[model samples]
Target chain A: MSTRSPTPVFLDTLRHVETPEGIELSLRVAGPVARVLAWSMDSLIRYGALWVLLMVLAMLGEGGMGLWLIALFLTEWFYPALFEVYAGGATPGKKALGLKVIHANGTPVDWPGALIRNLLRAVDFLPLLYGFGLVAMLCNRNFQRLGDLAAGTMVIYRDPAAAMPQLPPGRALPPPFPLNTAEQQLLIDFAERSTTLNPERQAELADLLARQTGLYGVAGVERLCAHARWLAGEPT
Target chain B: MPLETIAAELRRRNAWEATDLGMVMVRQWLGSIYAAWFTVALPLFMLLHLVCWGHWWLAPWLMWWLKPLLDRPPLYILSYALFGDPPDRRQFWRALPGLLLRRQAFAALTWRRLDVARSFTLPVTQLEGLAGKVRRQRLRDLSYPSRGAAIWLTVVGLHLEIALDFALIALVWMLTPDFIALEFFDLLDDSSQWGQLWLNVVGFCGLSLVEPFYVAAGFTLYLNRRAWLEAWDLELGFRKMAARLAPAGRVAAGLAMLALGLGLLMIPLENFAAEAPSRSNPPPPAIEESLMNPLCEQRRVREVELAQAGSSIKQALAETLKEPELHVCQVQERWRWRDDNSTESPPRSPPDPRPGQWFAATIELLLWLAVGLFIAVAGWWLWRRTPRAFTRARQRAAQSGPRLVQGRNEITIPPDAGLGDTAWRLWTEGQPREALRLLYQGSLAGLAAQHGLPVRSSATEDDCLRLAVAQLANPELLGFLRRLTRAWQAIAYAHRIPDEADARSLCLEWPRHFAAAGALPA
Candidate 1:
């Protein structure tokens, strides 16, 4: 129900799907731009490979031409499906772009889903150059094309797990007051991103909590950093 | 500049996601964006065509070249809209000249017109008010990480524009009647004035559709880059923390004063206690004995109170146990064989001994046997056709069986009766809610049965509407269904009775849309 709010508080493409095991998986659905780029990359690879095959086939006369046609058919049709099912839901291009196909419910793409989606690419390609697919993806909440929708699949960016940021050097100190979970996370985020923020702006931000910390300027910034370190489970 | 008032949720995001955020911005303010877009671009498009009337190709070429200029207004609107202060028409019109004539306008229109990341870099020049060397330096800074995505955004936008143009042509070709013999090659032949004009129009439509998304994507990408560089999300977080703690600080100050006052009051009490010498005086044994007697009596009284509390708790537990939720019972029905030697006679009369009766009985038995054979054949065919039919039937039975037992009755329209006539009759009978309910249920059932829409019984009205939009291709039918849904929602949720005219019109229109599909299976 929280997912279906008419006016959401925050606008992000992160879709949350709860599995049968009650674990929630957050998927950031890829948009049209990235998808188009990935498709283009795949197209280039397919064509390049075909061109090389054509040169080799030209040497072998008529039988090679027939063999080349069969190879082209296989490459055109089963190329994406094979990679999606066996290569962890990503074609070579998608793998290069760090994207993968998955079910709408966040499961990995299986053979049936892969085949259905790839087969329906013909419909999505109607009009010209996947125009219908582009329109469908743009209109969809999850950026699902017609093929993706029919096959109950979606393309998502395969985000690598982020390592914990090293806290700024400071003695670990407890927060002056009992900070809630969100506030503690904020403190940690501030500490992590402080390197990008200039000293003046950092001081300006720290000065906001001057009343709570009973410090201001650089000392206040350090106090917050210490709290962040403490919240990150640093001893003492 | 105040991050707190920023409409979009700000956080560290990859460049592509940032571009998607721009798409979100365009979607949210699409009306305003296009209103401003067409207001400026349509006239400009016409004017350019008029000026280049003799050279048919020149107009489209000029229009394509001037995309950077056309992109400014929408970006101007989006920038204000993002900070929660979308400009009114007059305000927007007033700002138009300044927005279009920014210091970088010349560079943007001429040398920078072909920039792959024009949208991404536009904000740096326009909103940030930087130009020339400063603008380049700023762009360099912003483009450090996001340049690749911005370039791709432009590339995709270019391809999308061409795709949409061809798609429109393809759509026209597909829709043309076969008897007309409109060749696809003829559609591509832009040698004639009409063909060229049509091509230009299609191209313009595609540009209009895609340009806003391009500009908005670029703008948000810029904003996202700025957010990362400046730690805007963290700044907002800090502001929120300050706002939250401000009141608490005042309360703490007030509490400190109260404590000070309480400490001063306690000082006098402590002094008074120290001055009391009778506090340390020893009493006699008779006084001690009196105290001991009272203590024993108090213990006996306490024991009685505890015993009374225990009995009252036991009574409450007994009372609580009588609640229906704690002790559920159900009456179940099952078929059982009747005893052959029952006291009550079978509820049947003795068979007639006439010869005509024997012939009638034979015909009836033959009819029953035929019916059973037909049922058996039909059942066998159904089983052969779909093995899962039995499982589905069992699931449906499991779902609906309990509601019948619980007496949760639903309205059932007879399959033979006309839906519109029945609904109208109900309305005239002053059961407006029932009439509307019948219409809503009938529409859903018709859609599910005829269209094979996956409209589950558990789906809400809104869900049904969404499913209808996805499944139904007939716009007129979709429109009718939308209106019907609105009317039904009004009655069901808001309890707002439809006007007599509206109710009558709905009933009359009902048969026009749904009659061909037949009534739902009761």
Candidate 2:
């Protein structure tokens, strides 16, 4: 577990969390742009709802004004907390953007965590327009704002599991030589992403493994795809 | 540039993630990027302000308009930095002019000044050196997918700049003392030279912080788009695979060449034997033919066998594909109402409101009742505590006299007797527990009376030790107190008596710790 390289092996936004269940979950932390957009959308919804309520409440005079004030207080403070806790860790805006708030340990946020983060929004909004919060987010590796840092929560992009690519119709054939798991996965990924590459590029890529496959050019590509199919457990 | 040396891990990323990568890039190279930025920007800002002496407002606008020019140095630094070769101060200065003046600088500051995706497209001209129609076509292709994010980046950048500017002003206003009475509105509307100069300084500060991030984000977005369009990750993977196999491929080729060379050498030797007829008798016709073309017959047989195997394998594959598991079609059964029921029996009517209204009214009434009950309970509790609160002050006043209580025992020390001398006498008389108790009680009383430690009468040995730790400045005194308390607790609770030497040491050390604080006046 301590065999970390001095420099990172690869750089990407994907954060890997290992659960006690012995599974590694890869989460992509959403950056500031998407978060800001989602926040603006939430603000629009919150205030837009409040404005409509105010209009209806104004017709009822003083009592309506008091009720509108209470609605304003709730929307300003508890709106995000309630939605985040109950709505599978997403507010309506976050859901629209396919983002969710979760604990730093990759668990669903509980009531206290949700309330603490939302309450600290007042501090994150210091000076004006979340200026301090933006700076904090930019500085943090996880892109967590001050509220998020305090509450031990983070916003991650909720990516669904990608479906397997449909392989081209071909007879499954085992590779001439044995392949390790990484090499086998590479072959499978090549078949998966080959549709996006040009035929010449595909042939070029396959030509790299030509020595192993005992083939070259288009024939090499077909052989690798066949190997990929076999590795994927297609009946051979 | 070699892909392996690129600092950032490149993959297919959306525009926002690419921008985030740029943010990470800026963080990684923050010191160098800022040094590059301020090295040119600060001088340019001062020069512009100096030139526009009285018209200070024009300088900031000019500086803002020259952002494309200002943005190049950091971009230049980052472009090299991305490939892990960050330019030094010398290289940065040397590259500054080319970056500022080259690549359609005139168009950027003029018609293209308002380009919302300026940072995103800036790299097309500056880094790639594309220009004219070629530059336009490249940018159109790159920006096609990411233009919206790039525009939003600019929009967010603009807002951030304004927000920071006002935040700085607000911070200054807030830090001002109340007696000074500085007006916020006056600060904004001030037309004086100092005010205008202050605004310029704040604006420049904001740009200095945000411009590097803006440039880096755009650069990464451009990089991301290229990586996606060209499939650079796959190319890198292929390069890696080729490198890994290069040695094996060379060895196999060498071995094959050696085998062919040996076979060629054998061919002549065999033919010579057939020609010379060196054997006692002429070789058989079969042997002669086999020697003449040693590999031809074996190769033909192997090829024919392989062709047969290939056809059989194909036949098996085709047969396997016909299996039921390979062509599974799931049939899902779900109950649904018939689509055509003539008029759906009867037209749907509005829901009855009476039950729903009554339920809602009941909920509202329950909520009101809960609130009222809470208030009533709080009032009764306060009413019950009012009389006790008034008498508690009198009780506190009545209990002001000093009293020394050790554990559950009260020790009344004679006013004139030396506490250490009396405890020593008690120890010698076979009353170790009582002697230890007297030492403990006297130490607490001394701490409270002489050293002004607020030792409570009910404080246990642990509590006394804690208070002494907090209040005592002398280590020797604190150490003495710790030893005395431990000896006392051993005899009092654990019923373990101390050794004679230990008992004598405590009696001697007690005065040094407690009596030195004027616990006993000689």
lDDT of each: 0.80, 0.78
Measured over all alpha carbons after superposition, the RMSD of each candidate to the real structure, in angstroms, is 31.0, 26.8
- Candidate number achieving the greatest TM-score relative to the actual structure: 1
User: To one decimal, what is the Cα RMSD in angstroms of model 2 from the true structure?
Assistant: 26.8
Off by over 4 Å in 1: A1-9, B249-522
lDDT (Cα, tens digit) per residue for candidate 1, span B215-316: 999998898898898888888887888777678686765665554654453344334334442323333332223244433333223323334455885345
Residue B271 CA displacement from its true place in model 2, Å: 64
Which predicted model would earn the best DockQ? 1
Residue range B1-522, candidate 2, lDDT tens digits: 878778777767877788888888888778888888888889999999899988988999989988999898889888887776667767777777788887789999999999999889988889889988998898887777888888998988888888878877777887889999789876686489888888888889888878999999888888998887767776777667666656677675565555465445334544543454334443334322334443433322222333445588534533443345532222223344678434223434777999999999999999999999999999989977898875675456324323544667655773124778899999999999988888887777667667777666557889989998998898988888899989998998899999989889988877776665543422
Off by over 4 Å in 2: A1-10, A177-182, A214-216, B245-522
The superposed Cα distance between candidate 2 and the true structure at residue B198, in angstroms, equals 1.2
Task: Give the distance in Å from residue A81's predicted Cα in candidate 2 to where it truly belongs.
Answer: 1.0
